[model samples]
Target: MESNQLPLRDIHLPEAIDWWPPALGWWLLAILIPLSIALMVWLYKRITRQTAIKAARKLLLQIKQDQQCDNSQKLKDLSALIRRVAISATTRNKCAGLTGQQWLEFLDQSVKGAPFTLGIGQLLANAPYQKSPPNEQDINQLTRLCEDWLNAQTKRKK
Candidate 1:
């Protein structure tokens, strides 16, 4: 057989090509950097929300302890603390402007009824400006209710 007609034909092969561009690293960085930033932001918000709830729990305990005393100031503080935590958990627009029965209802709706029932909500609604301070038992109950509400929120988040 002729050399050209043999089984081993004269086939030409091209040089190896580098199709991968250098900018691939930059493109990957662009996507991963923003993703990392977004993850950090989400983590920060979650941690802050948990911290706010912990602070609220401490404030509720203080209020309960002061129940045997005059507790007018403590009740005011408790009201403010709850409002702050609620706002943090949700948003200012959702919770900030609420007051009176509206505020109570807001709390009840947010917590999913683990703690802030209609009766407790009513009691808390009138709490801040009440002429008579709550007794020790009332304070204890309020504290337990507040803790329950916070726990419910935590569970819901989970």
Candidate 2:
């Protein structure tokens, strides 16, 4: 039959797809990209913190094992160690300037009691100025306190 005579109709096309409401892959991609980036950043921070903590632990062990150094020298080393670790764990502006009571107070934030301010930990403040070395017992106690502070650092949140 002739097309015009047979009453044939012209072909019709479907409407074009809309731009909104993207596909599942695209939505997943949008969500996953940021999540992956956040995870990477968190992992990097965790690794760096762990590295610093490990180094501090090794140094603590060294200070404990050094037999030749007198108690006064050991005290000085311990003080410096704590200060270095504090600066690494926080901003330099936050810890580098702290001293005496203020420094002790900052340390007490982690330990159960206010040891730095009230207990043998106070000896750290006078450590540099003390003409004579602290007694062996006091040195031992202060060493334990420093160790406790180190342990707290590991458990602390970044």
Candidate 3:
């Protein structure tokens, strides 16, 4: 038979792949990347918060037990410590500018009974400036209040 006379068929190929429904590996990568990033951020924040709390508590204990400083000096250090902890717990603008009743009120928000405003914590306001230091009992009470505030900050959501 002549070549032109013989029956023949054209070559055929399968359809091209579509990108809309990605492969299983791609779908898993898309889902896992964002989830891992979110988890890392959460873990970083939790670890930093715990570190700040632990350091603050240790410093507070040091201030409480120091033999070199008198109660007034200790009170001042405690006030400064609380300000630093508050700044870490929240933001500089929120914690730094506050003073007097406003500072006390801010500290009290994280704890029960508004202690910073109504209880032994009121000593944080002006006791440092008094000629006589806060009595030992008062100093001890204020330290406890500071510890309570730090613990409360840690328990709160980030």
Q: Is candidate 1 or candidate 2 better by lDDT?
A: 2
- In the range 1-158, model 2's lDDT, one tens digit per residue, is 77669976789999999978899999999999999999998888788777887899999999988999989888989999999998888768998999999999999998898999999998999767776779989988999999999999999886
Give the local distance difference test score of model 3: 0.87
TM-score of 2: 0.79
Would you list the C-alpha lDDT of every candidate in the order shown? 0.72, 0.90, 0.87
- Which residue runs of candidate 1 sit more than 4 Å off their true CA positions? 1-22, 112-117
Worst 10 residues of 3 by lDDT: 126-135
Tens-digit lDDT track of model 3 for 53-141: 89999999899889899888899899988898887767678879998999999888899889889899989897856777788899898
- TM-score-best of 1 and 2: 2
lDDT by residue (54-132, candidate 1, tens digit) is 8888777777666354555655666777788888888679889987777887778756553454655455777666767
* Superior candidate under lDDT, 2 versus 3: 2
For candidate 3, list the clashing residue pairs, or say none. Answer: none
Candidate with maximal lDDT: 2
Q: Using TM-score as the measure, what is the rank order of every candidate, best first?
A: 3, 2, 1
Judging by TM-score against the true structure, name the best candidate: 3
